[model samples]
Target: NKIVLPVASSGIAALLLPGGRTAHSRFNIPIDLKATSTCHITPGTMLAELIEKAALIIWDEAPMTHMHAFEALDKSLRDILSLHDPKAKTLPFGGKTVLLGGDFRQILPVIPQGTRAEIVSASISHSYLWESCHKFTLQKNMRLSEDEKEFSNYVLRVGDGNPLPTEVNEFDEDEEDQLISIDRTLVEELSSDPHKQILEATYGRTDQWKGTK
Candidate 1:
């Protein structure tokens, strides 16, 4: 039977999708991948068989995974599918349709103690597969309520590295070290009884939530 596989770079994102799993867990990807690495999936194994039958794969948080991870999957898929068709070895993802979803502005792959250049190099956009991939942009913020549009736009502007009108006077565009001040209205001040205020905000008033279990 044909199946759709849903995977994500992070556990939280995987849990948000139906029948989803972490890409590393599902693909048996190595923790330390190299340029010539392939996934540890053995041919004729249950996972390999499932991959052979997969109709499509949906990977969320794609930008958060290392380029090496994607390349590893590509090499493994090509090898696995080549068993059926010799030409599959040259095709991407073994010719199985893959839908990758993520905002590059949100987060890139993490490399411990890696410089900015290393982090950018580790992103999937730097991989060879990126050349063949089609790109789509989502222009609207569908999840935000009507009242949140301004805040959402502000957040987006920050992510896009655009200086806000309020910040133009205080920050120099050319300065390597720049800081944007948060609006006081958005901050919750806990000047008095900080612990109690935190508890009340998190779990509601003691009387309302006490001994409910």
Candidate 2:
């Protein structure tokens, strides 16, 4: 296979990739930030070598990383590849094919005590690269069954902070600005033993402890 496919993520999610390759922080590669306008990877490292040879680079969990991380990589790639073809310096990702995938609903770039605006500011969308990005969406709820599709749709709507459909929920206009009320029975059960309830919810359903036990 001549095409190199290197998949990386911001964290341990890389272990879940097909071959379990290391996905260190974007900044883990040796770089010189001072020598150029943007960071450039130290020219002789394994990372630079692989990047030079790779046909495709897939970076997962894109939303969880800071915009600077992507900018750094873009800058480094362009600097490294431009040596062979000066025109490559003007292309995104140094004119190399790259796919970045993630959901914005998941964990965003973490900022200490950050207001909503600060957190959004640190995301990839806030980066200059976003202007060249082509977006795609998945309409089908593949993870759910035909019977559970209704619930899945409701969950997605809630995640997007969209108004729920009338069939799923109906609320008064006054209640819209306030927290929605939960069922009394569910509240009573949770109040009875909140700690145990949480523990069971997290670990009771799986064989996580069976081997040790």
lDDT of 1 by residue, 1-213 (tens): 669999999999999999999999999999998999999999999999999999999999999999999999999999999999899998998888899999988889889999989999999999999987999999889899999888887788777877354455545767533565565656788658888888777788877866778
| Candidate 1 wrongly placed segments (more than 4 Å) | 165-177, 198-207, 211-213
> Per-candidate TM vs. native?
0.87, 0.74
Compare the candidates by TM-score and give the number of the best one. 1
Please write out the lDDT profile of model 2 over residues 1-213, one tens digit for every residue.
655554555447776666534334433543222212354357677767777888877777888877776787788788888988798899988988878877887889888899989999989999889998889886777788899876776667656767333332476766564443332333434558687667777678444656775
What does candidate 2 score in Cα RMSD to the true structure? 5.2
Q: State, as a TM-score between 0 and 1, how close model 2 is to the true structure.
A: 0.74
